[model samples]
Target: MGFFDRIFGRRSAGIDDPEQLRRQLFDAAARGDLSRLAGLCRANRQAVETHFPAWQKVPEHLRSDPAAMQSHVQVLVAIAQVFAQQLGDASLFQRLMGTPRDNPLMRWQDALRQAQERIDALEFTAARELLTGVLSEAEGLQGSGVDELLPITLGRIGECHFESGEAEQALPYMQQALALCEQAGDADGVRIYLGNLFEVHRWLEQREPAAACARRLAEMIADPTAKRQRLRQAERVAAGEPRNRVLAVIDGASYELDELPPLAAGHVRFMFERDRITLRRATAANEAGEACGGEGEYAEALAHFERAATADRHDPHCRYQAAFTLLHLRRYAEAESAYAEVERLAPGWFHCRADRWLAGRLAAGDVEHDVFLAVHALQDGPMAPDEKLDLAEKTLTRAPRLALLHLLRGTQLARLGREAEAVAAFRDGLAGDGEPDVRSRLLVELATHCDGPQERAALLRDAQAPAGNLVAAATAQLLARGSAN
Candidate 1:
């Protein structure tokens, strides 16, 4: 079972047969039976899994029948309520909304929406050109009502201005659209406008106003209609619990908490830690991401990691994480950049070594280089026990025999109130074969990780050499040879 399944329910939430479910889903959408649509959705969200096996995979339900597929497309757009619930899966929505060029209507809609998405991506000039084309065509469609064209056109214009660093200019258009959307009672439209307005306020350093908008947004996310994790995260921030902990309990419970407003300093530090700022606050929001990684919460970990990468301007660590996450997420090409970044950063890290080891196993072009990048994203200063534990898990899996690895692992485990495991790792390293210098260091580490002076003294004695000891026989022979030479 998936983590969400275990946390929420089962995968087969019982709307079997994709064709049958597709028909039912679309029929309900046509009838405006929101409760029925939600019932179907609630029963089978992973149904999207049946449709799109992965992000890149073809959707099965769409291929079953043309009418069903058209219905599926309409249901996707028509039922605003359903879209709200599925907001958490924006990429899925993007893919579902993506139709072939032969389907002119769907294609036009997709092109227009994609133009807006490009704007969100901060490709202002490109986005504006695309929007200009879209709006020109949309305007030619005389029957396209003011309600249909105005908000989208104005919103796109404001977005372009905002992306071009004109927050002041962006504000009025977004605000005006927001008021119109509110008056029209179009929840989704209001959300889009509010989202733009929030960005404008944030850019202008209007914290109080931004905070108020952010707070209202948080409330909107609380509506079941806005079941998006990112929106929920924003809501959590507005609700005053910013440093929230999303713990994937070992038993598969993804525990999310609300706490305090996030420190923008930490957010900034994390974003620019590698070099540039990421678009999102994944690094800032989920500082405990590594901890989740150690416990096989790779999916959730990937979520935060990818968000961070997508938000940034090609950070090596973020890219590396994205690649690794995609690898674990079973997306090979998607993860290629991440793996490539890893090689770029560390050239000597274990994954690179593994690539070298598997070179013969891979195709020639695939094995272009043996080098990998070294990306250490740990905090610059001291790390907490839990943090250390996370690092040890990630590192030791690759560098298991490094004495320092074991020492740090033991130290972290002990700190996390796991003294027994810590002591065992320490003793196991100390007792294993090693040179005298290494033995001395291991003794010191054991002393640090272990409790009581007696254990420390015992370790010290084992590390000590006899008082009457002289140079080793091999060194003596080498000295004699040197003299002879």
Candidate 2:
């Protein structure tokens, strides 16, 4: 019928039913009726010897002696183990043996190990039953020295519920375990329970409680670097709602950071500073792009928006602005590519799908613009200077109205050592209604090659009127030079 039945046979070893024999042995041993147990074993001597050869060597007098019942319990436990392993029915074994007292802690550990095995097999009900029974026994021994085992048993019972996807059911058990651990001053146990509570509350989407648990766990961490990292994570999870709560979390994290070891403190501080700089740069570029777009300076807006996107690709709004500005500038292919990225990053945004469609339609019909072609060629750093100049000139011929094309031609001409041609091209682009930042950049370039003091001063002053890092630096240098003279 079953694997065990096939191996042992239905009525082998002279026992008609192994299950009935197991029960009689348990009853006799539990009642301290060694006389009855010996009688039964003697009647089923062949069955006992066949299943357990060691039992044949046990002296007959010891079998009926109450003083030697501890040995009798061991034999019974061994028999129960055999049935549990062969029949895969541990209920009778667990009920009959409970936890052996020959070596109480070792017996408890064995029971826990068996329960874990049952859990691993997805036999959650069996695991829970075993853990509950063990917990009852452990609690009963509270007045004994075994009181320390109660928290561990309670935690195991909670683990059974947690593994079974009954987090709500697991909560009270974990809380009780935590209380006992606290009462016992078990630091490791407290850390473990807090960590478990954090996971449970997070899975339940109870953010506030989860955050509280996270904060407690962070406080329990002993390693300086690990503690700082955990505190940072706790700060993030605790973020939201009333300003006071958020501030409290941040302050707590900051306090922990101050307590970090010197080397770890320096490393974390460097990381924080780098992140802050990156965020500030991205924000400034995004804001500058918005300002330029508001003033209808699409070319300058596109430059700043691209910078913003490069600095922080996670900012969907920056990517979208770059795409929109490219659309206004009639760079359809670039706009389409940018919109595709926006769609990927923010699929559910209200305008993403519509904007993607519009960009796709525009890009399908429009020819590649000369400005885009020239910029692409210049981006190929290995291209010869003459080839770049040719590309720039071709761009100017096709889109004579685009000021950036003129600037491109000027820069390429300057690189080719044609200062006169570069100056003329820069002035031509400066005359058109391009972005102020672009105009300032052109003036700075032109001023660098100017020979006359008056002309250089004028170019620097004009460049200083616009806001840009390069323009500001160039203007300040020239002004300081003039003052020195």
Candidate 3:
């Protein structure tokens, strides 16, 4: 069929084949037909790019053109959907932005802009797919354009974490992206990430860093019309110095203590609650602990964190880390105490305390720990529902990296009759590349559901059997149960 024939429903010639095929491919994409989309892109790769182009740069003046607006909107929506579904091939979408035929569209500025829109809408799955594709392509691209995509990708990663409620984990990526923008002399990008950096610091309860970011942002906003140049000129501005002023919540935004911005009473209360935490000031001992930890002084860091915890029993972060550090040091008693304190003070911030506690119990070589492990070893065995919930919540909050956490928490939840939450947790767990220990643990956890030989095979396949023999034995028992069933 000819092009016009396809449009007019006359299939006399083969000329309309490409157009018909393209429409079908798009429809398939809309329905999440991944296999079909992959086949279509493979067969009509050139046609796809020709229709979309390497860079669909919609000029600002085209805003009034309804057709142009519609076209952009449709393509963007489709692209975003593909990313969300985690579809197989996106070569065609990348080609629209001028990527080489063999290379996917990882660093196209136009695509990045659209991806940013999806992020703003809280469509993180789509955002991540888009960013991941961009990063993959970027690994091979040696051009300055790759640099342009770097900060944006980092910012998107931060957004993904933030949307999942892992605000603490989001801080580093935002700061990293801002740093890249500064290095690249991308003034606009710098300004954008600066605002993001500010928000991340606020979320982290790092008042000093947030204040600094805000001050820098104020200095950057010289002339609204000169935004581009203003960004470039940002390097010349003096870095913000820490001020003694400590405002709780002036306006809706977190600000210094001295100046109160005009904010509604309700907003003020919300902001105050979010921003205020009563952790004691970090002393010299605390600094030493952090310094030691950063320098790979594990032993020294453990000591310092313990000392800091000892100095202030009320600090949850300190207590939690001290507990974990003690685990690494094989100090079971101290670790248990620290973990118990954390549970008492901040029950909301759960991150594998039960498992850690179990590890502690086993390490002590006590009969009680052995008995607990033995009971938990059975296939589809009962576990505390509360612990599973805590694990799921923690996994969700820290997604796209802690896959093992997702797997463990999801499996436990599945065993406890929370199927929906279990599915969500497993999906998130599959989202990221987890560490080897986490991966092994997850695999073992998954073995509990597999029947017969497969379960035994999975246990044998574990690359790192967790340092504790009891955990290893429990894993083996679970596999045996799966086999028997």
Candidate 4:
């Protein structure tokens, strides 16, 4: 019932209960909470003596279990030793774990401190010798509390190599350290080491891996501003500048092109690969491509679009618009190939090319050319009036505010001899706030389907002002109608 009674296994079946207390101490140590851990160690001081022997009795196989109270107490003691070393007290580990200060654990603790001092003194050779010795011992102590020392030792060895300008040699050790840090659930360690890894990858000219690190950090970090900043930074790394300066790997670091190895030089001939990132970026050249294509500079537009496509291979808009430009350039085969790739990537980039071309052809003379977008295709000429009317109605479902579509609908109905329906379609076109030119055309058409002479004349009067050709056409129609009456 009491804490000590539960910890000493008085009930034997209650061995699992003290594990909760051990876990609390381990958690505090992992969090770098020295004060909290110190308080816990003091409170559980008596429990440690009994738990140490219980831990020693564990089967070697059972010792590997992280939640075993045996390993928890051991790791907790290791953490306390680290604090004691930092605070310049030699008795903390022995006092906490009820052990003499002459054990293998104590030797490793002392070695760790000497290695740090050597590293700070720039004696990398001595530092590495010391750290690696501890690393070997830690690795052999697997399944014990010594598992917690693996990343720490590995990380320091990595730093020695890195600071000595041997990043390539440091790479494997640093990577292992990062993995162990993550496994230990040390958030601060992970965040710090990720940045270090990102820099090393970049220094090695490993853009994809570097971008991967940046992207992962951006997602895991809690700061909202930093997330967006890192995502943008990730994309830039992913979409690295064209023909970036490739460096040569030297004594564990990067060097200039002049020093490139033959194998690395050959690598330059390989096509630059693109990194596929999730965040979308606006390809500035995409807008330039559109403007150039609209101005009839098809070749220039194709080049601009190609630049954007190369910059971001996964951007569907750039790829799709490139295909559109190729078609304008009359490179049909290239256009088809680009479209096929776009289709393979996923097909949401929408441009109503066929509809805009068909509408332009139909309104060839003196009509203000306004581009309209529609999901349904209005077939190239020779379509029957009734078929066209059906297509126009379908297009209106997706683009109800497209006044040009309304005008087209009225024209088709008039051809189909639906007088009243034609009039109503034209009225809808004007009511929808069509451009002045389209509205003028609608008024003239509406008058043709009006039932009475006065209604026809009234509609034509409104049509005569805006469009130059509409004025002549309307005046002539009015005179002819009056004579017929």
Instruction: Give the TM-scores of the predictions, in the order they appear.
Output: 0.33, 0.32, 0.28, 0.35
Leading candidate by TM-score: 4
In order, what lDDT does every prediction score?
Answer: 0.52, 0.62, 0.55, 0.61
Residue-pair clashes per prediction, in order, are 17, 0, 12, 0
After superposing candidate 2 on the true structure, give the runs of residues whose Cα lies further than 4 Å from its correct spot. 1-107, 120-123, 143-145, 223-225, 240-485
Model 3: how far residue 465 lies from native, Å: 59
Model 3, 119-224: lDDT tens digits are 6665666876777676766664433455666777788888776654566877877888988888878898888988777666655556667766766776777675
Give the alpha carbon lDDT tens digit for every residue of 1-485 in model 1: 67775544333346768778776766877897666666566677677445542323325755556565555556665433454554344544555545645333454566667876776555677877766666565552322244555676678777776656566888876886788688778899988887777767755656556666765776777655344444554444444431111121223222232222222222111011111122333344244456666566878877767665544433345555555555445455556555656555433232332322223222333322211111122222267778767776676566455444565567667777787898887776665434343344456556655667666556555544321011111122222233334
True-structure Cα RMSD, model 3: 24.7
Q: Write the per-residue lDDT of candidate 2 for residues 337-359, one digit (tens) a residue.
A: 88778656544232444355546
> lDDT by residue for model 4 over 1-485, one digit each (tens)?
77854443222212245677666656767676665555555556556445644444446666667566565555656655644653344455555555325355666777888998887665777899888876666554544446556777777787777655566887898798898889888877788778777866765557888888999899896887668768866776777732222233444444333333433222222111222321112256788888997777978888887777665555556667777666555455566567656544533123222222333433453222222223123423467888888878977776576666888888888888887888889889888744555666677777767777777777777666532233334333443444355
Displacement of residue 83 (Cα, Å) in model 2 is 35
Give the higher-lDDT candidate: 2 or 3: 2
Q: Give the distance in Å from residue 384's predicted Cα in candidate 1 to where it truly belongs.
A: 26
Once fitted onto the true fold, the runs of candidate 4 whose alpha carbons sit more than 4 angstroms away are 1-61, 64-101, 142-145, 241-485
Kindly report which residue stretches of model 1 are placed more than 4 angstroms away from their true locations once superposed: 1-124, 132-144, 158-170, 203-205, 218-404, 407-421, 424-485
Q: Model 2 residue 21 lDDT?
A: 72
User: Per TM-score, what order, best first?
Assistant: 4, 1, 2, 3
